[model samples]
Target: MSTPPGAAGKGRSLSAVSRDRIEQHLKFLVGVRHPVAAPAALQRACSYLEDTLRALGYAVDLHGFFDGGQEYHNVVATRLGTRRPEKRVLVLAHFDTVAGSPGADDNASGVALLLELATMFKEWRPELTLQFVGVNLEENSDRDGHGTGLRGSRALAAFALQQGWEIEAVVVLESVAFAGGSVRQAAPAGVPLQVPPNGDFLAVIGNELAQGVVARFALAADSFDIALPVVPLVVPDNGELLPDTRRSDHAPFWDAGYPAIMLTDTTNFRNPHYHEPSDTLETLNLAFAVRVCQATAAFLLGMAGGEGAAPS
Candidate 1:
């Protein structure tokens, strides 16, 4: 486990997450974002998030990169820790949707939750820096995830290493907020675990290094009164070493030797509209999205050494 020297501080998540705010962010992201095809639209979407984070008093950091000859942008909103500003915990989600889809649950939900957290914790300064990142170019299978596939995340991970920032943990939210009435989630093939018959639970997948954080994440959900059927997956290797687990932005952190975990609703494994045009806001389960934000607040607060005393 290549973890930083800091320990998870005893603290509970403070602040109530507004469902309305979550909804608005989701609408704004999914309704406005365009993928590989529309550069101008994608830039506009990035600007939208950047402006919102700025309004919430977060210093927005843009990491610009090029993919397949097209320049892409990643939006970072940071709330530096008062006690350990040198160490950081990253919360990231790609804002760019795949071409031909609206991407409500695919990722807009992820960014919405990230935005909500940025707002929720804006004033509650923690002991570790919290970076809410809206990454881009994550859906491309061509980037080899550990290297190329994760455009924005790969760059951010490299930048953190170059700057010698002590990364306590990196949490990536993807395909969140799509659960209802006994939904059964299936783990990727060969990763042995009997998924409940109902795919209604949220999944937290981590590498061996992230085992401890994953445990706390489940407990945090319960502590925050978010009754999610949370499933914690700890890959025995550098998750990127395995094909099944290296599925999202979190994969790059593991490749960079940082402890990272992903919170997800398990895209195509459950939702039929995974990358289709039908992946719109109307199909999303907003109530489920709210639970994700609440649970995330709990996990982040504890990780950031904030005021909440979640379970050990």
Candidate 2:
């Protein structure tokens, strides 16, 4: 996991991602977006994501799949690379929310960051193709009879595998907003992992295959002066022993043998409003999300090729 040159510097592209833009995205997306429970809201969210990506000059594609004779969609916006278009990197987040909760921090934060990255790199041609994917039905664990969640991501992973796409990395964002100086943080009970006392940090979890990605994110997180710390955890065997680490879209890419990692805020471990009705936009820390966005931009730019590009 060699660090990209100048990896410990603030992303030059950070100027393109702003706190206001993130809030705008969250304001419209932070709601109960379920396929069955709130289909209209779900569709509206999907349309908004598509339109936003399209406005950013991305050729958005609604990748569709079916489960039990029902159809679902994954919004994919591709940014073709100039140096190596064959190899690709994925920046993805799920948009669907769990029933009864608005899921502001649970996922709207992640989706907001995804859109921000899309805008940041809209005109910058990287070395590796970047795909910003907004997936659906990530939180449908049992409410909709969807067995285990991540159906959208699992389907996309399978589609990528079937197409034989050369995936360089998959960066999944999951609940990346909430952070506080005094907020309590804890790992699952009996996991033996030492968590920070405060939640003012980001967690980068990956499998052995994604150690390099996790290391890059940790370095990027520290590169900026945003009071945000990064905790990098590389689990063995795709986090099979620690199920909490597999609770996002990255898990599907890991299962498909692609190097993948998740950027998160340790959702249920630190956020009391997680999966509750109180998880609204007002409770989110936009500053925290901006920091995450900056670090992620640096990380992705470093991975793509370099930081020197014409302003998008």
Highest lDDT scorer? 2
The whole-model lDDT of each prediction reads: 0.79, 0.85
Compose the digit string of candidate 1's lDDT tens values, residues 1-312.
112222233343334778898888877778435554655767877898899999999988888777666677889888788777889999998887776788899788998888888887777667888888999878764332333467788888888788888998899999898887756555566766777766788889999889988998998787656667898888887764457678789987887889999998888888888889899889888888887887887777668875432212
Clashing pairs in 2: none
Q: State how far residue 96 of model 2 sits from its true place (Å).
A: 0.2
Worst 10 residues of 2 by lDDT: 1-10
Q: Can you write out model 2's per-residue Cα lDDT over 226-303, one digit (the tens) per residue?
A: 456888889998888888889889998999999999999999899999999999999998988988888888778677
Worst 10 residues of 1 by lDDT: 1-10
TM-score of each: 0.89, 0.93
What are the clash counts of all predictions, listed in order? 14, 0
